[model samples]
Target: MLIKHLIGAAVALALGANTVMAAGFASLGEGLTPLGGEKSGNQAGTIPAWNGGITQPPAGYQGSGKPHVDPFAADKPLFTITKANLDQYRAHLTPGQIALFDTYPATYQMPVYVTRRSGSAPQWVYDNTRKNALSAKLADGGNGFTEAYGGIPFPMPKTGVEAVWNHIARYRGEYVVRRASEVAVQRNGSFSPITSQQEAMFKFYDPKGAYADLNNVLFYYLSFIKSPARLAGSAVLVHETLDQVQEPRQAWAYNAGQRRVRRAPSLAYDTPIPAADGLRTADDTDMFNGSPDRYEWKLVGKREIYIPYNNYRVSSPDVTYKQLLQAGHLNPAYTRHELHRVWVVEGTLKSSARHVYSRRTLYLDEDSWQAAVVDQYDGRGELWRVSLAYLKNYYELPTTWSALDVFHDLQARRYHVQNLVNEEGGTIDFSQAPPEDSEFKPAALRRRGLR
Candidate 1:
């Protein structure tokens, strides 16, 4: 019998609570979803049970290397929530959502669709998750984790940091290559798209590898600008470490104008993303990423909220950017919101730490551990930014990920959206052979740039 106090003994001692629990394969697939969510639906029966979520592609899907076809295309919105109806749905909406209604009373709204439990992973991933449930443990004061690989590390997390770790280490396939664009939409809705080709090798989820083989590196990422002649040929490479406190993330950038490659140490934490126009920080990349050492995480329990889910329309090749991007946010006509149970985790900056966001509340989907919505606060403890991840299951890979990520600056009245591939010939490709480790080296980055 293996038992561990999730969030670590130090946190439990400080919080003065005994949260120790036993973990094994017995609870998985029995009392909990394969990935650790509640197996049953909500009391209202709006959200359905996890009946082995979309393990196969829809009938109309053309297969890999194509845009995913919406399985719920025939479903209609149950209702819409605008500024006028906001009060009625206030209990189901996040504070950031309410602020959006107040910020753009006329345009910003939520088109609530039927909830679909379409989050899933392969059978092997489920098996690995069960293994991780028994082995994974927090390391170096919640900065990272150890003794887990190939699946979610903390399937049945007992603390906020453990839940956050699950989000950071969720299964994202072994290798993938995607071509997408990012745009920082201004107040008037005018913007220039910054397109790029990105690739990632999830070493932590490598099917052929084990925990002992990780060597602290979780994944390798490389991105090169593809369009807007001025930024073309520029590239960035990153070696994301699992234990960041022990070894910070190693990053390198290739500047096309300078024709030189240099180490990029400013790619972590609160550093403002170059093309983001200061709307998002570097750690805000995948909803939330990097180290968790700067903040105190608290598990605020669960809530049934309307979060963006199964949003195939927003990622459709048929929807043009001009028609999708509105002045305040993405056109509500294409966004799909559904009511589902989510785990709410809050991160508050430690009094001694320094960062732009003083506090952040993250709502993660119970089934997938994906951050669906995040409300960020400034130093004055005022709402400053809101981030949403439009989630959809890539049925072919049998995994759910964000089709588009939108970061809104409530104060500036502008937003930035990324991972737009509506016009791209192909989307994410997980079938590609994994690239050599050398490809992520600084020398390779310089070589790829010169080409």
Candidate 2:
């Protein structure tokens, strides 16, 4: 383990002694729903509780690996939230979301849609998550895990760290391959496509793998940039691990310019991302990543809020890039927000932890344990960046995840939206099977880079 003491070892420092054994499997049926969502929806009818999620495609659906046409394309926005009516919806808006409107009063807005609780996983996954609730436990100050694999580690989460762990360990299928683009849109709405072809093997989420089989690895990722001559031929390979205390994340970069394969320790924590131009940090890639060792995570309880949901529209081939990318944010018309209950967790930087973000709060969707909304704060405790992820169901796998991820910088008036493939032929090819282990190896990256 990276830390000398685990949460189970130092119960007093991690969580109160009362919470050490808080979430027993008994709570799953009574208070918590089977999928870890609240059994009952909110008191108001605005948000509906999750029943059986969207396991099949809508009417007129094409086969997998094709473009995902929005099922709700005909639906209209229930209402629009803007700077002019900030006071009316302050209760549902995060500090970061409100800041965006304040910064770009005329441009930034949110189009609210009706709530839809339609995201489900395979039967084996739900069974594994239930099993994990009874067996999984934290290690080395929440940096490692024991007795968990192929499921949400902490379905009945009792603390903040556990909630975040659920997000990191959430199911996203065993493997995937896609052609996508990331655009760091400038203030004037002009941007170049930092396009790439990417593949991942979610070994930890592999249904057949057991906790003992993980060996501390989470997933194997490879990204090869394919656009704009300046950044082409550069590739990154990451073997994300569960426990940094045992073995930290293994990352390597094959730089076409240098023609070398070198170990990359700088891909974690506060390091500026390679192609983001200093707008985002390495750990900021998936809303929150790397390790939770540098901060004190606190479970801030649950709340009902409007978040990005069922955003298939943004990924539709019919929607052009120009219509989606705005000066400060994605065109609000294409964005869809709906009310959902989420687990709120806050991470405050430890005094000894050296990182750029002092405090960050993540809003995790209760149904999927996905970090739907993230508010990252600077050293001065001021909100600096806001991230929103629109979740949609991959009907073939019956898994739900981000269709588009937008990271906005409040101070710079710049942002990046990754996983955009409207112009690409296929949105995301889910029909492919798990990749071979050799494909993610460092030598493979070199060969692929040279090719």
Question: TM-score: which candidate is best?
Answer: 1
lDDT of candidates 1 onward, in order? 0.85, 0.79
In candidate 1, which residue pairs get closer than 3 Å at backbone N, Cα or C atoms, i.e. clash?
Answer: none
| Per-model TM-score versus the true fold | 0.94, 0.92
Runs with alpha carbons beyond 4 Å of true place in candidate 2: 1-31
Minimum summed lDDT over a 10-residue window in model 1 is located at 1-10
As a TM-score, model 2 comes out at: 0.92
* lDDT tens per residue, model 1, 1-451: 0000000001211122234444334568887888988889988999888888887898888877688889999999999999998889999999998999999999998999988999999999999887777677788988988777898888877789999998999878889988898889999999888888888999998888999998999999888887888778777888888988899888887888888888775567887886788788888888999899999999898899999999999979999999999998999999999998999999999999999999999999999999999999999999999999999998887898999999999999999998998988868888888978888788888888787
**Please, what are the lDDT tens digits per residue for candidate 2 over residues 131-222?**
77767778997887788778777887778888888888788778888888887899999987777888888888776677788778888988
What global local distance difference test value does model 2 have?
A: 0.79
Candidate closest to the true structure, highest lDDT: 1
Kindly report the root-mean-square deviation of model 1 from the true structure over all alpha carbons: 6.0
